[model samples]
Target: MPKPASASALFSGPFALATLSESDGPAFPALVRPDEKVLDLRVALGDPALTVRGLLEQWPTVLTRLHELASTERESGESYRPLAQFRVHAPVEPRQVFQSGANYRQHVIDLHVAHRAPGDERPEQERRAEAAEIMDRRAAQDLPYVFLGLPSSITGPYDDVTLPEWAQQPDWELELAAVIGRPACRVPVEEALEYVAGYTIANDLTDRATVFRRDMPQIGTDWLRSKNAPGFTPLGPWIVPSDSVGDLDDLQLNLKLNGEVMQDESTKDMIFGVARMVSYISQGARLLPGDLVLTGSPAGNGMHWGRLLRDGDVMDASITGLGAQRTRCVAEAR
Candidate 1:
C-alpha cells in the first residue's frame, strides 16, 4: 500500500520552506518552527511519490494546496519571521535562458545613431533608413533575436552585481522573464500563454563597447559575446504565478537607479508581445519546464544617454505585483 501524505512529508527535500528571521540564522522546517520562516511553497511541499519530472507534472494541484496552507497560516496571526534574516535563491533551475535585443523602437533608434558613422548621411534620413531596415529584418529574421547566457550568469534577488574593470559601459535592461511550465514545440501564437509557469524580473546587463564594435562581424559570434557577459542576467525574488497576473498585456514595469526612476513603460508597448515571441521561439526550439524567455526591454536604458553603470551604483527593478529585485554594483576585485 502507498504511504499517506503528512505535513512532515510536505516539508521534506524536493519541497522545503525556510524562514528569514532578523534574530536567527536561516530556519528550515526541521531546524525551527515551520510557522516562523517565510513560506517557500516549492520547498515546503515535497512528494516522494513524484519524481523530479512528475513534480512539475503535478504542479497545479501541489501549488494550489501549498498556497492554501500558507495563506491559512498567515491569516491566523502566526507571527511569521521577516525576509531580512535570509536570502532567496532562484526558485528553479532554468534549462535555457533566452533574451531579446533591440526590440524597442526607441532602443532601435538609439542604436542606429550609436553605431552609425559620424557623418553617415543626414540624421533624419539615417533614422528613417534604420527604422525601415529593422522592420524589414524582423520579417526576414522571422525568429526572435535570442542569445544564450551561462547558468553562472544568473543570480538571485539581493545578490551583488560585479562590474568587471574592463566593463566601461555597463547598462541595465528591465525585462519580463517568463518561465515555461510544460514541454512545447512549435506552439501557436494563440496558445503560447498556456505553457507559461509564471513571470519574474530580469536585468539583461550589457557592455556597450563590446557589443557595438563597428569592425566586428554583424551576424557572427561577437553578437553573442556582447549579450552573454558573466553576471549579466539576474532574476527572481518571486515567480508570480501566471494566474495571479491576469491580462499580461496591461502590466506596468519600472526600473529605479539609486532611488531615481529610469525606465517606466507598459508591456503594451512591446513591438513583439510575449505570446508571439514564445510561439515563434518554440517553432525553432523546444521549451521545457524551468526554461526562461526574457521579453525585450523598453526604452530608457543607460546606453542611450552614454551613461553606464559604475561601482557603488544600486539598481532596483520591479514589475507590478511580481515583486522587486535590487542589486548593488561593486568593482570586480583585482
Candidate 2:
C-alpha cells in the first residue's frame, strides 16, 4: 500500500510532468507545483516512478507521494516558484454558497450605532421595533445566511473585480470559506466540522444599501439587487485542506484596502463557530462537496469608513493558513 499524501505535497511542483491548464477542463487529483503551476494527475501518473490509477482510487496515495517530493525539495534547499506563478480557479464547483451575518457582537453594536442618531429618543415602542428588527435580522443573518451567486461569476486567482454602477459602496470582507468534503444531511453539531474538506479565503463584496435595507425590511428590501451584483464574489487562490490548518477558531483574519489595514480580527470572536454553523445549515439542505460556507465578516467594512471603492483600488484578504487573494477594482463597463 502506498503512503498517504501530506498537505504540503499536493502543492509542490517539479513532478516530472507537464502542468495542467484551465483550458484542459476538469482536473482530478491534480498537483500545484512550487512555481505556482498546476500539474494534472493524469499526466503525472504517466510517470513510471509514481504509479497510480484514477483520481478516486489513488487520491490518498498521490497525496502521500507529493508530500514526499515536497519534503525532499525542502531538505535539499531546492527553491521553486511562488504560488502566484500558478493560476488558481475554484477548487470545486459548488452547488450553494452560504454566508452568515451579524455573527459578531461588535458587528451588531456597530450596526445599531450606524442606524441611530446621537441622543435620539429611545421610546419603548421604538426599542421594541428595534429589537424585533434585530431578531429578524438574526434570521436573515443566520448561521448560513445563505444566498446564491451564478456560477458564471466565479473567477480564479488574481482576477479583476468589476464594481457595478449601482454599487455605490462596494466593501471588502475577509472571511473563512469552508468547503464541504462529503454529503451531509441533518448532521449533528459534534460531527459538523468533520464534513469539511478544506478552507479558503472569500471576499464577500457587498453593496451596503442592499444588505442594510434587506436587514431592515420595513426600510426596504432589495437583497437580490444588492447582494447579487455581477463580479461581487471574488474567491480563490487555492484551497488548503482542513488538516493543514489546526484550530479553526483561533486563526487571524485581515483585510488590506490599498496599502492600509482596514479590518483585523480573530475567528475566536465568532458567535457561532463552524461546527454549529454546519450542523444548522445541514438540517434540511444537504451539503455536497464543493458547497461553500462563508462565515461572516468582522467590523470595519467600507460603510463603516464612510467611503467606497474607486477604480484601480487594490484589495488583499488572508487567513492564517489559507493563502491570500489580491484583486483590483475596475469600473463596470458602460
Candidate 3:
C-alpha cells in the first residue's frame, strides 16, 4: 500500500467551489476560503438542498453571491468548519463527460513516432517530420475527436483507484476539464467561453494494452473497455471560477508519478483550444450545466517514459489554478 500523502491547501486566491463530506454524512457543496476554512453552501445560501450542480444551474447569480460570501470575514460558527474535518470529493457531479482524444499537437506527433507500424523502414526524423505535418493539417481542417465517458468512473481527488486485475499497461492522461454552466446547442466558437462555468483537473486513466481491438483490427480503438473502469477517472479537488483563472490558452498542466515529474506542458500545445472543442461538441449534442469537456492531455505519458502504472504508485495531477488531485493506486481484489 502507498503511504498516506499529507493534505495541502488545494484552493487559491479568494475562494473556489468543492464538495465535502463530514464523517459518513452525505456530501454538501461548499465555498472553500483561505486559512483552510470551508463554508457549507446549504447553510451559507440557506438552501439545505443545494449542490454544486445546483449552484452551476444558477451560475451567474450564484457566482456573485459566492464572491460576496468568500470576501466576507466571519467568526467560526455552525456554518463554517475547518477543512481538515471533512473528506473532499469531485467538485461537481457531471451529467455528461465529453473527452477529447489525441488533441495535443506534440502528444499526437510523439505517439505517432513511438508506435510506428511494422516493416516501416523510414528514419525516425523523417517519421517525426511526417507526423508533425499530419498534425498541422488536421488542426487546420479537421474536427476535434471527442468521446463519451460515464460519470460512474469518477472518483474523489484523494481516493484510491483500483487497477483492474486484467490491466496490463495502465497509463495516466492528466487533462484540463471545462465545466459547463449554461445549456448550449450549436453555439458559435466565439460564444463558447461564455458557457464555461469553471475549470478542474481529471486524470483519464487508460489500459494501453486493451486500447485496440486485436481480434477485429478494423473496429479500431476500444475506449469503452480501456478507459471507463470504475475509478478510472479521478476528478477535482475543486473548481476555480473562470473569471479567476486568467489566460486559459496558456495554463500549465503538470503531472507527477510517485513524486517524479512525467507530464509537464502548457495548454498552448493543444491542437484545438477549449472554446473550439466545446463549440464543436455542442454542435452535435446539447451541453448541460455541470457537464465536463476534458481538453486532451499533453506529451510525456507513461508510454513515452516506458513506465506504466503499478500497484501502490501515487499520481499527483494539477492544472494552473484549478487545484490538484493526489490519487493512490491499488490492485483490484479478484
Q: Using TM-score, give the best candidate's number.
A: 3
Give the lowest summed-lDDT range of ten residues in model 3: 1-10
- lDDT by residue (tens digit), candidate 1, 1-334: 1111221222211222221223344323211222334543324455323332234455556556645665554433343453434545544557688777656666666666666667676776767677768856774666567766666677755668888877778788899888777888999998998888677778888877777566756654454556566667777655656776656787777888877888888887666778888897888899887788888887778866667898888888877756667888889988
Ranking by TM-score: 3, 1, 2
TM-score of each: 0.79, 0.74, 0.95
Write down the worst ten-residue block by lDDT for model 1: 1-10
lDDT of 1 at 260: 84
Candidate 1 global TM-score: 0.79
Q: Flag regions of model 1 displaced more than 4 Å.
A: 1-37, 40-43, 47-57, 74-81, 118-121, 124-129, 136-143, 212-215, 218-223
Q: Tens digits of per-residue lDDT for model 3 on 152-257?
A: 9999998999999999999999999999999999999999999999988899999999988989989999999999999999998888888888698898999999
Q: Rank the candidates by lDDT, best first.
A: 3, 1, 2
Instruction: Using lDDT, give the best candidate's number.
Output: 3
Model 3's C-alpha root-mean-square deviation from the true structure amounts to 2.0
The TM-score, computed over Cα atoms with residue i paired to residue i, of candidate 3 is 0.95
